[model samples]
Target: MKKDFLLSSNDQLEKFAGIVNGDHPLKKVTPEEKIKVGVDLGTSSIVLTVLDSKNQIVYGAYEYDHAVQDGIVVNFMESVNILRRLKAKAEKVLGRELTTACGAIPPKTGEKSAKVVANVIEETGMMCTGIEDEPTAAAKFLRLSNGTVVDIGGGTTGISIFQNNKLIHVIDEATGGFHMTLVLGGRYKIKNDEAEKLKRNKEKEQEVYSVIKPVVEKMAAIVQNMGAEINDPVIVVGGATNFTEFTTTFSKVLKRKVYKPLYPQFVTPLGIAMFDE
Candidate 1:
């Protein structure tokens, strides 16, 4: 793909992040307009995204919760409740009912994980339209036809390699933002919640990152060990890739330039919305 295409995709991600961040108002849509909804039951949070028929951003919201662990729904009812609240909130903002939606899970997590994700979506009263692998969903939003997608999510780092738009090799490992939090907690002697908060604090990011850098390096090692040919445009997405030195550190280990779109955290959630049809 052209470099310009990636630049534009980053622009789209920026716009979507702005909407999710409340920097932009909810998009106005006609009653006849069709909307797509995506439910992302992430380890750190559950995100709900809405897009128009043209795939333009409409609204997005997220709430932090431990309803899921390592891309699986460990607390089914809690996951359902969080998604239910997000749906209600979206409906109130969009002034219409969301009857259908899609979701995603980590690659190779199997049909059981997909079923649970579908169940969570259904329990929220929305028809589960589809379930996709997290890296593929991120790749879709990034418009990557031939490249690598490294999704460093809250609970796992998923790697997907594509050739001619076909996903050829994929892997998922249990080293992600949660692991970083644990590392930070160990180094700071803080609780998990406090470590998580500290990990995200802008002022403390450098300190937190220094403590968690090894974890990031380990995540890169996971990718390097995948044994598949890493292609160009190796894009990193998901909430775990939020740190300033994330891609830089990952690239150093992998010995390749990695691209990260704006608001990497929201990439998968927004991409999940693309499968809502």
Candidate 2:
């Protein structure tokens, strides 16, 4: 049997049009016509999204937990168990067995680590169709005309530079949501678990932002360090970058326009599903 592969595009505008207008034609088709799924095994959460033959979002589900730390499958069985539970939930919502999906990892991850992610997905009774870097996946979803993709997930900051919709460079470094949580935890003298919850509270945005400013600044330095390589606006994604003023803050720091898509957190998973097998 032939294997399916994820979609890789160099044209940001084309990618964006397909996602927003749903003109990819795959989305218009039925579930039977749609045989592919996308599973995002993020450090902070694992998300699964399904697109029918016409490429429409038929079902999507996600679970938040530290099963995978720093994009590595720390507890193999625990991660697999989480994937299994999410798979069942997604199957229930789609009303069918979802056996094939694409998964992703960061650009800097080793081949072995990427395979581990693929293996975890397969353990859920689903075929791992394709695997790509997180920022690459986000780029496919955004289809930016020109700029950089900054994916600030729980454990790492992934950066992908693109021009004319084609990826020209890629970089991934450790330092993301986890660092923020650690900072907040230290400042309040609370547990890391409680700090995570407090960080998500809207009322605590100001307080949390103040505490994590240094972390964000470090992220800014990462961007600044890579600025010479990219020329377009910067697009930010991932759960860590979901704070209320994140984009604005990043914009101010970088002195460039930063755009966050609708449901920014789901961007990579959706892009993973769009991979054309």
Candidate 3:
């Protein structure tokens, strides 16, 4: 079965904005001829988000795959090919060419790796305006104020410590959805392909979580150890934390406030859009 592309509606986006921005009089920007786009090139998936000038979500879509690994563009042409398809589909839905977009990378990426991400966007015929770290991107989407942002993507966990709404420290480590997949695969005696499917199966959630609990706990410990002044609430984003019980599990282990947006996976993409000028 094909995955559902539209995870949340405009109404949900509004609610998400309210949560992140707090109760302020929101000024709606009239839809213009052109829309801004944000793309998240994740380890396990690629996400595209379109927003009006007012920063309202107009249309968005995401596709899942294991094409890229650990924030590295292992299959450069393949990644570009996937983005081309995604951009085409999104243009069809929005009735416009997504000629410009902002993209992101994991924290502490080398200049070459960062350029690779920009090149992928350029290959899609979209001019890349800005490229930022995944955690910084999440903080922008969440409109965070003086808090740590933890982005757990498919192959790595990125942590950013913020104070006074400024990034103070950034760190990345190999620990994420792929780790969960490994645990689930070993426990169920299934191959990685089958394990991925089971991970998304609502009916198998209980069984899947049981096997991945230890790994998630270990991830929480990693966050706690890395973040010294992260006593403030931690905002969790990225596809890895999409598990139903993820927040509860992490919260229990960390013993602190953990917040997740409505569609956690799209946080980085939305943040990328926010960075667009």
Estimate the TM-score of every prediction: 0.97, 0.87, 0.87
State model 1's lDDT. 0.89
Q: What range of 10 consecutive residues in model 2 has the weakest lDDT sum? A: 1-10
Residue-by-residue lDDT tens digits, candidate 1, 159-196 = 99999999988989988899999998899899999999
Q: Count backbone overlaps in model 2.
A: 16
Runs off by more than 4 Å, candidate 1: 1-5
Clashes of each: 0, 16, 0
In order, candidate lDDTs are 0.89, 0.77, 0.78
Best by TM-score: 1
Q: Candidate 2 residues 120-180, lDDT tens each? A: 9888888888788888888776556577889888888999998887888988898889889
